[model samples]
Target chain A: MRVVKTGIAGTLESSDVMITVSENTSTGINIELHSIVEKQFGKQIRKVIKEKMEELDISDATVSVNDKGALDCTICARLEAATYRAAGIKHVRWEEK
Target chain B: MEKLRRTMLYVPGNNAGMVKDAHIYRSDSVMFDLEDSVSLSEKDSARLLIFNALKTLDYEGIETVVRINGLDTPFGVDDIKAMVRAQPDIIRIPKADSADDIKAVEVLIEKEEKLAGLKVGTIKLMAAIEGPLGVLNAYSIATASKRMIGLAIGAEDYVTNMKTKRSPGGVEILFARSQIVTAARAAGIYALDTVYSDVNNEEGFLEEVRLIKQLGFDGKSVISPRQIAPVHKIYTPSQKDIDFALRVIEVIKEANEKGSGVISLDGKMVDKPIVDRAERVIAMAKASGIQFDEEDDK
Candidate 1:
């Protein structure tokens, strides 16, 4: 679940969110979210990202998202895609233990 | 259950925006495409995205179909594995040439259904006969499994196999289209015509729809949202046809009650096939939101 390299997923297209996970020297996870709906759904979006990162046991990485009004499922999917790419994993087993 | 499939819209599997909002368009079926629409590197991403979208998004009871890559590609097995778990109404097999192609995917679907604890045979199959071999074996492919609900002609690959490009008149694909429709009819399944790629040409699209309707296609596969209403309009039974069908059903019911085998309407003899067609017209009319009271006939 370690971030081995810079991994990016998703697109900047409307209803999609672009996520990037890269190495960070900071002690804790750092997230920077840029979204038009930041005033309203920002907290929830960040919570989703953080929860996915935590599920992957990723505690220390710099994550950035440029969201274009993506839904909760899209956000989670993009996060999972970026996380798998960052961990150098090719296939994702969503049901895996 | 015979569902209305007049307009099956193809949305790229990788596009989250389209997937989330597809139901709003009211297409008879929203086909999440994982085949030609997706590039090589994005196959996995598209599959995963579609899986999650199916699990989370509400298609509002619209039929959800996914066109998976051919088994020749490495991605096909994984696509089936993931898609079957998501439980779409139908899985469209691309470039399917023979019964074996459908059976192979059915085997995988069976395994996935068991592993996922889904009802066996819950997911139906549709085949896209895209090449010459596929067209030649259309009937076998259409009847290969009980799970198959429809057969569609993919004209792009078909015309290429014929060494020609698509013309406005569509002379090259007439044979293939006819063959597919006949086979689907023989198999008692639906026959869906391929997409009209030129979304901007309203005249050309309507003309093609008219041709397919004349050729007895049950429905069509559509690429864009704009094509939906036109196809549905062309497929919906007219008011006259609906009225005739209701009268036919009423007469047939009366004849049955009287223990009579022969039925006639409007000085014309009515038989089983005619009654079947009439029933189909009423079904189409009802599906298209044309309401009529059956109690009125009583």
Candidate 2:
């Protein structure tokens, strides 16, 4: 799925990550991440974002993540939701994932 | 055994923090709402959030309920499709005025259950009676589908539909409450009372809890974590009552041992109803983590 518009999901809550997916930049996936626990888990968090973006087939988009100690599952959920919203898709094919 | 449902806590579907930590509150059931509590603009976002939460998070065996939007709305069908696949313990139907309204959702749930590789009846149904029409047809709605497990009162809308507001004593919705409770009993399902919106008024909340407990409600829908403890305390059997219940059980067991068809305890006949009540009280006591002697006197 391609990010046609800038879609945002999640909150700045203590255990949540706010995901902002921008329109297709056509230069592969670019990620900018700011996190509370970046020093200890920055690489792990980036790996999650990159893997989730690849899983959703979201190519060539500017992805921004503001993490507040959210878990791996939460980060994946928020990114998938943001990607779908940017793609203007309502129905989620959960079985495929 | 009947499960203790003294408190069913409402957690907003969109709040990731609450969704992750809801089970720690120890409510009998945690209901994630995709309806009125969530704003219109965040409908898609909230649905996706709750779906993932249900699929991944460990609720630690506390019953999970998801209140979906009405089938009339644009988002309602999507809510059902996602929530059915997500597999919460129950899905509450909002504005369920008639059996057809519930059947509409059930049909979709059945189909989704198949596609999701789950048993056809894996997901249960709970109806929210919100208006005078629904109150009148309470029994039908309660028994609408075999998957129906409860009927909950939505007093805010019911009171507004009656052209009034909630009073201090809840006099206006008395008939609705009694009727819903009666309908639920008649249908052999659970009867859940509405939420007390006055979160700060502990006295009033206790009073409402007492009234509903007296009226034979199985539980109350609570909005705050603070409301849960009081409801559990109120639902817990009193020590005096528990003592009497223990005696009743002892006598009944002794009679059965002696091949007696009838039993008497404290000069009154202990019938089936009495035994059932005693068992229920014991169950509640056990649920409250109360322990007493169980050695046989014989």
DockQ scores for all predicted structures = 0.57, 0.61
Candidate 2 residue lDDT tens string, B1-298: 4687789999998888888999998999999999999999889888888888888989999999999999999998889889888889999999889999999999999988888788999899999999999999999999999999999999999999999999989999999999999999999999999999889999999999999999999999999999999999999999888889888888888888899998888799999999999988888888778876657211
lDDT of 2 by residue, A1-97 (tens): 8778988988999999999999755688888999999999999998998998888887689999999998887888889889998999877885553
Largest TM-score belongs to which candidate?
Answer: 2
Candidate 2 steric clashes:
0
| Model 2: DockQ score | 0.61
Number of the predicted model whose lDDT against the real structure is largest: 2
Clashing pairs in 1: none
Worst ten in a row by lDDT for model 2 chain B: B289-298
lDDT of 1 by residue, B1-298 (tens): 2578888998998998998998888989989999999889888778878888988888889999999999999899888888888889999999999999999999989987888787999999999999999999999999999999999999999999889999999999999999999999999999999999888999999999999999999888888898999888888888888879888989999999999999899999999999999888877777788767869434
lDDT by residue (tens digit), candidate 1, A1-97: 7888988888899999999988898867899999989999999999998897888799999899999999988988888788788889887673442
